[model samples]
Target: MAECNDLFLKFNDEIKLGSEKKKSLRKSRNAVGKDIQKYFDETLKVTKPKFWGQGSYMMNTIINPIEGEYDLDSGVYLMHLSDVEEEDWPATSTVHNWIKNAVKNRTSTPPQDKNTCIRVIYKDDYHVDLPIYIKNKDMEHPKLAHKSKGWIDSDPKELTKWFTDEVKEKSDQLKRIVRYFKAWKDFKANGDKFPSGMIFTILTANHYVEGYEENDDSAFVAVAKEIYDTLDENFSLDRPVFPKEELLEGWSETAKNNFLSKLSTLITNGQKALEEENKEEASKIWIKVFGDRLPKYTPPKEENRMDKGYALQTTEPPVLGNYGRSS
Candidate 1:
């Protein structure tokens, strides 16, 4: 991992700049942009140059403005060598070797070190890996576009574009989401341990639910509803959850302390309430503890009501379960 101190210091600098931080981020993204450009320029001599991930910062979407570290991502375009036969469509390894050879032959100063093996380093920093076979040079359409649910499951290049575009177009909504996530992250960091990938999945799902479009009817609301329903089915107040130590790394200590404190309070109060058979007080305390972490929805009082006489009383547990797991 990079130096945590260095990362925090840089993060602090960017946060002090206010909106200027966005521009600084744009400039940082341009480094990857230039690298992609160089890949096209260098590889075009040997193989065709197809579409590159020209979209804005992929890492910026889910990033907390307060957090300084941001990973840069850009998909490199690739094409087959003209002389290479179609019979040798190229195995994954062969395609990787082709990238190695092309990077080795570059005239411009390489972004990566010369001795760095292509396949290993390429896959590590880029986040995802795939083989793109192109016979002709065209920098227009994405390398692959798969249609789904009214929109396209297109290349991640499009996803990157969508993320940046949404940040610009739905600035207020994006800000709200950012604020929510920032708070959610802090809240989760403080005591509530959730799945490691939950936040990223939620961030991505928000865009996906919004229907991969730039319009109002994007699928986000519906997706949120579905997630809400799922969670309603699976929540249980008796369970004890601790922050997964391995996932949070640096923050694990903080999370662990938070978890222990919260868990102790929960158990102590819970046992007292149970001894008194005050389910209502116990339930309310649990809700007070974790309700904000739940999905945004008006719960139907009837579903969780203890009895018909208790219909007017809001004693039931709020929505529960793995809301972020499905959809």
Candidate 2:
């Protein structure tokens, strides 16, 4: 029988970011950090322009993005912006535009003024989102600057910390499972079929049952079951870090159904994999669920017993003697 563990581990490696890319990403983010500091200190003359990483990178759930696209999110917390109100401590447009101008000339296209962040699109599959934030003394809490509504309470750092702590408390196994789910999200995001990364992350954390998963293969199986194991059709996901944060608040029903449909198919395939006698065949089933990144299934070599108590690998499945015909 082929080793299921080996297959999953190999698949995980194949789907994850490579060493060269990891180095490049780190370098790029470091340069970004410097750009933020330089623009604020010299150009804007603002003090203490600090930023922290959010999303998949901080959570260690980073995976290869679908197609040739990739993205990173960073929160820029500016402490000193002049002539701002107590209600609106940090001006959203001012900060967003500053970020926009900083990276505008650098990117292939002009920096976009998103709802909360200024997105810098790269030539290749790398883009970074710099969400403007404010930490006022009066508010005493980090508030994200929203273009439409002004300030809103959003702590990506808090969320990241919560996930990190949970992965620590339970096991690293959970984090790997999270990556697998994220990969599934990226894979199925052809159109409007897939849910947002935040939605999937919330659902996974909500439904994660720690002990059931021993490793990657079992973890995938466990998570597949856990998604459908819920009794309620209208399931609501709450952030583990911030219970008040509603993940699926305005998500469309069509999107939910699409996500669930894909997840259900994965679950059904996983069930079949568990029961199948041929290990190589089971891996093929998993490959269908995961996609082409998963390795092609190869059966174990048959060991042939010969003279002198020696063993040799046969080209085909080895045949054993001791045959009895019952008529």
Candidate 3:
């Protein structure tokens, strides 16, 4: 019988980011976080700016980073931007520029002003994304700035809470399964055609109910199949935690198709790996799906054989200290 559960436990450990690396990344993130807060405290002169984390890092759904770098999303809320005093407050560009200028030299390279956030790259180590939001006193929702799309309502805290709650309910195995999906996505995507990390999280969370099989491999296989079987071209990922947030709204058809195609292939190969009796054979199938990140199987170290030894057999519990043929 295949000890697939045991093998998967070993594989999970191999892909997990080490405690030392995580500690270092957290330290870097904290330094920049303080800088962002300090900048607003000195200059903004409006309602105080609030800073918090979002995305994978905050949600505790982080997988091993794609390249060598971890991407962190830190959110800063300008609560006064809610007021519609057109003349006094500048557009998002000013806010973005202020943040960019503040963190310019902090990053290894110059900071990038992306569509919705300012990105500070730390080269081979990690990158921090600063997404600025406006929380209006008049309204219940927070609006994110997008150069192209204008202010869009989103609730990062709610989204994070939802994922965190599910992971707790299902145990950390839910997170491991999510990481497995993302790892496969990272290893497999040859170009920019893959779905966003949020989509993967939402989709995985959608199909992830309780009662997972005891084995990690079987649980993952079941989750993958559930997603594959239930997915449709018209599928929309609604943020179950956030009120009316659609995470999958703007996904390109090409990207969706690409994701589905890859998903089907993974399900097929995962099924084969599960059916395999030989671990080496099973690992080969998994390697084809997961690529080089997955650890290859090596037979455990065998005990040294006794010279002229006989294979031990037990019809019943053998009497210890009695090596001669039993009467």
lDDT (C-alpha) at residue 210 in model 1: 40
Q: Please give the distance, in angstroms, between residue 319's alpha carbon in candidate 2 and its true position after superposition.
A: 18
Query: Could you give the candidate ranking by lDDT, starting with the highest?
Result: 3, 2, 1
Q: Give lDDT tens digits, candidate 2, residues 1-327.
A: 223656677878877777788777777777777877887788888684777889887777788876766778888877674335656554677667777767766656887898978877777778788888776655545778788878788778878887777777777777777778777766666776565666666566766765444346656766666766561366566667643676666767776677677777777777676656576787788777778777766765667777788776577443222111100
Candidate 1 ranges with C-alpha deviation above 4 Å: 1-44, 47-60, 65-68, 79-88, 97-154, 157-171, 186-228, 232-327
RMSD of each: 16.7, 5.9, 7.4
Per-model TM-score on C-alpha atoms: 0.37, 0.86, 0.84
lDDT of 2 at 312: 60
C-alpha lDDT (0 to 100) for residue 4 of candidate 1: 17
What tens digits encode model 3's per-residue C-alpha lDDT throughout 63-155? 675576788888888765667543355677877887887788786699999989998888667788889887766667777777567677777
What's model 1's overall lDDT?
Answer: 0.36
Candidate scoring better on lDDT of 2 and 3:
3
lDDT comparison, 1 vs 3, better candidate: 3
* lDDT agreement with native, every candidate: 0.36, 0.69, 0.73
| Cα lDDT of model 1 by residue, 179-289, tens digit | 333433444454366433233333433443443223211122233334344433532121111211232244455554564454345334333422322334433442343
